[model samples]
Target: MILLLLLLLPAPALSAPGRTRATIPGDVPVVVEANHLLRKGEGTLVASGAVLVTRGNDTLRAHQAWYDPRSGELRAEGGETEARVMARVDEGEGPLAIEAGQVTRLGSGRLRASGAVHLTRGQDTLQAHEAEYDPASGEVQAWGGESRARVTARLAGETPLTVEAGRVTRVAAGVVRAFEGVVVTSDEETLRAEQAEYDPQGGELTATGAVTLEAPQGRVQGERVVYNLRTRVIAGGEVAAAVPAPDPEADVTYHLRGQSIRGAWKGEPGSGLPQEIVLERGRFTTCESPRPHFSVDAREIVLRPGQRVVGKGVGVSLFGTRLLTLPRIAVDLSGEKDAPGLFPRLSLGQPDTVGLRSDWRGTLPLGGAASGYAVLSARHLFRIGAGIDRFGSVPFGLRAGYKEEASSRFVSGLTLTVLPAFTFYLPAAWSPDGPLQVGLERMPPSARLYSGDIEGERWAPGRRYRLIASGCAGRFSEHPTEVTANRLSFSGALEVRPFGVLPRVQVGGALRGRVGYYSTGTRYGVVSPELSLYWEPSRRDRLRLDWRHQIARGTTPFFFDRIDAERSLVLEWRNRTPRRALALKAELDADNGGLYAWEIGYSRRLECLQPGIVLSQRGGDFGIGFTLEIPGLSTGF
Candidate 1:
């Protein structure tokens, strides 16, 4: 039995060949089997036929075995079942299984397996032609067959990652290191490097030595890459990424060459546009040939796609010569000249005005969602503005300064032309709050005029039902409009989602109330109910309808206002395809039985710009406007 047991399971850690001391656990029941067994001493065993052994949490099986009492050596040979030598070690995690054509236990915490060597644990596996294991250190070193052997691991339910190299080793638990022509592939992304290290337990992966990664985004090459699964961040040094056009049909792709790249993302590297991406010592270009035709080199660059992209210490070069050098900006990379060099903006239908009726604008990138934009209006109308982050998504922001509309140049005064004011957003998740503005002489002339007015609002968080309450109180001008009015007004709205059915039909409504009073005497109060309906039959088509009503005193009014009797309706339709979008809007005022207004717009993407036209009839004036956009660039407010 001792000889048979030795053939099936090797002696515990201490019993291996060269150890000075062996601490064998007596609690483990060793079961052994064989056609024949011979024991020279407690350490000597020889067995043949159906040999198997079981040690605490480990087992070995073979058809034949030989043991030396002096050296404490064991040898297992194949027969039936290929008599394949197998080792199954359970170290808390299922088992670390090793199988090979031949197995040798050298007794001093050393083991060797040759021929079809394979190791497997859970969803992870390693295969090679030969391998070695150190029982004392629990390290596995493997060599490939005629072709390269590989390691496969599964992480976070994403996809199975496969790694291969000329040589592989597992010196520590849950950590694997591969050297020479190392390649790791996950989904469609492939990373190649001279060496790679993966730690499944730590959720960390890294590669070094001319690392190159290929994904849908394009191709990236760098000196090293370190990715942490917990942080969802991929960082690399000396990186160059070629990101192709998001649309597969587009012929252009941007090559982002940088000293380093660090970003947080969920996609399999490159398939999904990335946000919060930072690049240092970077240059961006569209050329893919051996040499770039043009490039924008910058000291530092930050990008939050669909939000903003900023490059600082920038130089735009044509071929090799620097064409434009600027400190920073939202540089347009659409491959078209920016409407070709300072074209004057001319506007008609304006009364004789001293300043250019509109403003010429330019923006320079400073940081995330923050930029310095200078509007070149007349000296009197020119203004500079900046804001930090996006209040809804990121943290911190400056709404805007209280800039009053410009009166004519002759009559314009600091008090009447502009008010000194600013607004800040409070840090919050989900809802926008902590917004308050104070304007001194910067009041809206159309609102009966106000001075020292402060307004704020709060909202209840939820989509099933949304509620917003807002109020404003300030001094009304002792002027004509509302002279006797020391004004205070409050408004609140509660919206509910009535249904969440499929087919993408949405139904919603809001009950709103408004109340206003003047210290002098006049007051107005009303409650209105609004209904909205939206239909999205497909990704490209949508329709929406909105209905609202307003009510005032009746012939014989009651003390409290009831639901508005006058009705108003607005209907809109939108259809969008790959390159074109069409929209129509119509409004009807049933209170007075009149048409409020209607507008139609069509936009199409063109080679150089997305030109759009708008025609509208409101009140009694007919207006037409044209829009031009450089594709793949930021366009509006």
Candidate 2:
């Protein structure tokens, strides 16, 4: 019975130079084949002459191999004239293939390969002199040994990448770690560091130790950097970068240094430079001088290329000297030749009555929905005036001190706007020269409502008519003690452009009627008709004439509601171009001296500067003003 069982067994094991199968008690069965096979000490098998070994999903082929069934370990070596030993292991993350001069499988399920090792899985490849592979986790680690062969890998993802380092390790399916002189290259950016961790699946590369990233747009260097391959956003600490101009035609670059930085690219994801970047404890400048001609240092800075730069807790320096410190500041970089951003302005002039005067205007963002502007003037006549305006949903404006030859304690107004042409204003004024005491003076709170025209397109095509209705109620006075009346008034104005034949010439007319009732039992009615002729001879020149006639049927005690002018005519000529502007205006009014008043103003716009002059004559009183403005820095308030 024993002899028959022996004969029934496979003949290959018994035959020399054939295949043998070794079954372990708790492991997968091992199969070995070669031209020559021999039994060594303690269940150890030696195979030579084109040895092939298979255990589970792992397959290895070499010229000679040694397998110990007791320990479940295998080692293979290549022959002198033959190719190196090669092994392949099938795992969850594709098949791992390794080629080396010698390969060893330890009992702990780890494979060690040396001597010009080359590993591949899917589209990823690794080259090193020594490497270790974990079949269960599909992790491959390569390092330089005595031969000092650097490890290199090529990863094929959305962006093809190449990594070279002294040591490289595959931590996960798409995660790689590199150390010691690491360089990662892709189409969009190149990165260098002493150590880096890259996850191609997540499109993130984190590099540390004097890291540097260079892209087509600019370059960044820092102690550490984490870059998104997909978004092309770079974030790091102790960062310094040179960002190119957002305008492609411009050849300017900005330098930034910060404790920490985070930014993003604009326009399309892959193309274009960074549109916005933010830095903490940052210094930013466009000057390339070693010390920089001008720079801004701030607690926090936000840079929007080609638009503007905003800074908080900022200190501005010029020529290494600190010039100013501000809570917040914004600088515009739109490259507009004429319409510059808000800047502090100082002008010296002489008014009709006020002596030598100096005026200053500036704009400030009040944060949130409100931005505030102020105009302050000081006169030699011991009169100081200030006007402040806030723009937002509920705009508030205030003028204090003497203005227009009138001494005003304060004149303040608040406007409430409702959608679709409804506006209400709480108008109040208190003047020392008025009949009323120094208290709250309601200058007739008013409400204005309009329709039949688009808000910003009143002069656009298609709109031919507009209707405006306004009402006010309260005390009214043009001067102190001129009238003692509490007035309620309602007015309506209708404007129509009935002519459509001449596109370049616009002939429009408006009729306005007003009715008022006074608390002192005085009622008045007034009607006003106005005609306007506007001719645009060219894109840069226009001529306009306006004739207004007013008639009164009844009179009110309040001069504020009384219309004194029975007839008025105004003619204006304006010439405007990209580089210069000229304006001429003449007015004739009856019932108010019947004097013909005229004014002429001209301004020339240079690349970065503008100069203007205005001369006016009103009833023998002549006035003149000369102004010099920096186009990008003048606030023209």
Candidate 3:
């Protein structure tokens, strides 16, 4: 509602063709101009042909206007063939303008505008079918739904705001209210509520009664929500939220129910993504079922959206049954598919090999690009040991530490990239059994003739070939014998995909050969040639088969590097959907003419959690294990 204080002072009427002016007595004189002004019946006046009324810095233009001196009533309208009536007022920062089909000032000091009414003040604007303003009460009300035109208001800034509803009212300066299916959109967030009010002075919008806010990052619903437009902060009560897939490439959505929640976003100024959020007395789950299979409850939870979530006084539940409780728990939003099994990581070991073994592993950052990892394991009953290794990479240089499980030897190696496709490594090992002895383990230089992504299933027509060759000379302390053994070895592999077309179904082959000579008067040479066929039936499915034959003459002194099978056939299949995946692999021994080893794995994804199982069999040994992992925080059980 706009207040137009029109106080007219009577002036001599004119019927000439030229323009005439009538003035109003005021601090800022009000002037009325018309091409023709005529005295109507009694004290009534009529102004026609380009009627213009100006008061101070404000001006109104219309085709015709009628005024009654006694009633102090005025009416203005656009001609049948002319544009709508328009008015503009300067308000310091910018101009305020209004346009309507017809406008009237009632005897009771009420202003009404009908038919395609539009009002704009500075960066804010409103549009409706009709509007009414009462100057005495400083209230303006707009209605639109009846004519199939909903009232819309726009508040523009860096993060622009637009609201549309059935009705809108301005009760005071900088305060606006809306009702009935009100929707407010600010940048990427869209909010809907039964009723809402906004205060431009404070940059606050309060929504009540079934409030819901949705954005690209997630969805939030509550009974009431107060959002700070400028700061992009949200505070709400009794909220339920669904954070779908941390990003667009994910398939999971985490559902959270909380008594109260507060969130703040950090990104592009108007991205509407909450990077930090706090929820009180809440429970969350990745399960989509109404009755969740698993959930975590916590007294307080803090979330760093798309990164991790931390909870205090946490309880984990499965099928409405409490499984465990802890003082605190934190999980990453990115989940891993395959990880070591539950607490005290257990692997089903063959009795003839290592029997049952349990291991605990941890990693620590050693600063810069270096990290240290440790593994403690207990095998059978007599063997218990811990091994630590530090690995780092600087540009093209590599540093690594490793442990030989069988002989309890610690090995450290440094590799330097001599060229883009060539590297040299020097390795040394120290034995901790009996008397400590350190010796040079090996020196290896490797070169890759060519490297390519031949299995990417894309049509890049060319003959793709990859070849890598390396040679090593080393002195190792062989167990059970005190004598030192000197060894020289060479290994190389050459793979070539001769055809570039038919990328979805490609054929490849590789020739791999190794030769070793020991000062202990033992020599071994082996060569393996393999033919592999790969097929990708669709984006979600892949199949590959490999037939390999090895020609062997002698055995190596090291048991760990000895070849167990000479001829084998391997087949692998992989299938994936948005939320589920399956993988299977099998190998057959051609010499024994029977199945050698096989494995099957399946997993389902839910947000940041992926729990899976693997079943495998080799020879007479069978094994099964469960795995859970979080990729973002890199933790698993």
lDDT of 1 by residue, 80-176 (tens): 6665877776653345677778888785847787777767665456667777777667677777756655443232224457777777787646577
TM-score against truth, every candidate: 0.54, 0.54, 0.62
Each prediction's whole-model lDDT (CA): 0.56, 0.64, 0.62
Between candidates 2 and 3, name the one with more favorable TM-score.
3
Off by over 4 Å in 2: 1-26, 38-46, 68-72, 136-138, 145-148, 157-160, 172-174, 200-202, 231-233, 265-274, 288-290, 339-637
Residue 240 of model 1 has an lDDT of: 83
Per-candidate clashes, comma-separated: 8, 0, 1
After best superposition, candidate 1 residue 289: deviation in angstroms?
11
> Of 2 and 3, which scores higher on lDDT?
2
Candidate maximizing TM-score: 3
* lDDT (tens digit, per residue) of candidate 3 on 25-115: 5455556788877776785778878788766666677898887767766788888976677766454334556688888867775668888
> Residue 440 of model 1: what lDDT?
17
